[model samples]
Target: MENSKMLSPEQLYEKKIHVIGRITILMGIGLSLLVPILLWIYYGVFPPMDNLLKGVFTVSSFMIPLSIAEILSFYPILGSGGIYMAYTTGNIANLKLPSAAIGMEVADVKPSTKEGEIISTIAMSGSVIMCELILVVGVFLLGPISVKLNSPMLKPAFQHILPALFGSIGAYYILKDWKLSVIPMIIGILFSAFNVPTSVAVPICVLCSIYAAKFLYKRGRISL
Candidate 1:
């Protein structure tokens, strides 16, 4: 009788843990889809090519350190926050604080208490402040020097650099689940080709991919 009672409690605990795990995975998936959509929309509207390239580089350069910080946050295991932070701060001329605040909204996880939300907000804000300062100084000191040197090559050089950097970050995950990855990438490309807004296209493509993957997995067509 005692063993039966203990078994019930153990099973209950396991059930609760499983639920929590599912919730976390779902939250990570949601943020992974949502944040990119928001960034794409913002870029589409603002269209800052010079700052965009710089921001991409800055984000790429700090990916390792920011990823560590994100891991410590006990949020999603993916280092998207760091990448988002880098992209936002690198591009916007003077809106880092507001951008970070918006980022926190997009990155918020369920079951995150008020305190946790505040902490995420503050952390992102601090990152923006520091990154903005560095970007300003670099542009001021370096921009003129490059122009004076007639380095027309620098623009294209950095343009190629940003795409390569972002592509590398994306490749990290793509290689993990290549079979599942292709579905979303193809959908996203097709959606983008239609000139659909990034905010809508991203989530739509993600949902489509997720449902398709589940369908294929259940049918034994894919390992997942």
Candidate 2:
């Protein structure tokens, strides 16, 4: 009790955030499994154990690597609360990442800082709410929306949406410190040219960027 009372505000906040984040993650897992479990029970449909294991192995082979890479790459930037919220709500790369990055940028807060964590969490929550609302509206207007989206005029734009979004975000940072960005950009381009898998490429890029940054900093070419 005395030690707990003596903890700093930051320590207390960290403890609280971890407890809440753990609970949220557990709930997310339960909810994800609940639907499949319910459907199986209701329909009395169950796959043979061998087939089920095969299917799981095939999917996990592709997904597990990517999942591990994404968690490692995004955790430092998103922090704990932001991570829990983003993963729980899904759409991390497209929505939550951009929202959190922009929020932190606008707030002039660096990642891993207290201010960054709060801003990131808030940005993630806002994105989740907006996503839910858009999904609800989309469900009601699915037919019209599908027709519009499928139109040739809009099809190209939809097809390239992810690239366009990331390009815009990348342009900002690349322009901000073109020197530090050069090595990573070249690495990414080469990896893409060779059709490297993203799961493998992401960690390679991260490591290359880190070494590049360190080398540049040692030479006084860029400030950390």
Candidate 3:
């Protein structure tokens, strides 16, 4: 009781956040695994156990590395609350992170500060709720939306939407640090020249970019 009374509000808040975040993440993962296992049990047709391990490894090889990189890149800016919410909500790079950044921009709070942390969490939570509501509406309007989306005139855009989206967003960062960006750009070009699979190329380039940045920063070439 004495120790508890002596703890600061910030300390108490962090403790609760840590406990809640762990539980939420654990439960979410458990439920995700449970769904597939339940389906297998219901069907009475579980594949060879070795196949399951192989499948998990094949997916995780890329996903785990990418997730690690993203977590490292964004966690400092997001802080604990935003990190918790964003991880649970999904779409960190395209949706949640952008929403949080725009909110901080409007609020005039800098990232990695206490005020920024609180506002980012609120903004991301709201974004998650808005996405869920939009999803519900989309489900009801699926037929008409599908018809319009499937139109031949729009097919090319739909097919290339990912590149279009990332290209637009990536253009900013590339221009912001064109010198540092050159290495990754060259790496990407080389990968393309060699006809590397996107899965292999993406993660390799991501890791290479990370190491390159670290090397530059350590050599006093750039500021954090």
- Could you say which candidate leads in TM-score? 2
- Compute the lDDT of residue 177 as modeled in candidate 1: 62
Residue pairs with backbone atoms closer than 3 Å in model 3 (clashes): none
True-vs-predicted CA distance for residue 44, candidate 1, Å? 29
The TM-scores of all predictions, comma-separated, are 0.38, 0.86, 0.80
Query: What residue pairs clash in candidate 2, if any at all?
Result: none
lDDT of each: 0.56, 0.87, 0.83
Q: TM-score rank, highest first?
A: 2, 3, 1
Q: Could you tell which candidate, 2 or 3, scores higher by lDDT?
A: 2
Q: List runs of model 1 lying over 4 Å from the truth.
A: 1-144, 148-150, 216-224
The candidate scoring highest on lDDT is: 2
Two-way lDDT contest, 1 vs 3, winner: 3
Question: Which lDDT tens digits does candidate 2 get at residues 1-224?
Answer: 78779999989888888899899999989999998899899998788999999999988876888788788878877998888888888988878988898899889998878899899889888989999999999899997768777888887788888889888878877887899899998999999999998768887887888889999999999974
Q: Which stretches of candidate 3 lie over 4 Å from their true place?
A: 172-186, 191-224
Of models 1 and 2, which has the larger TM-score? 2
Model 1 lDDT-worst window of ten? 74-83
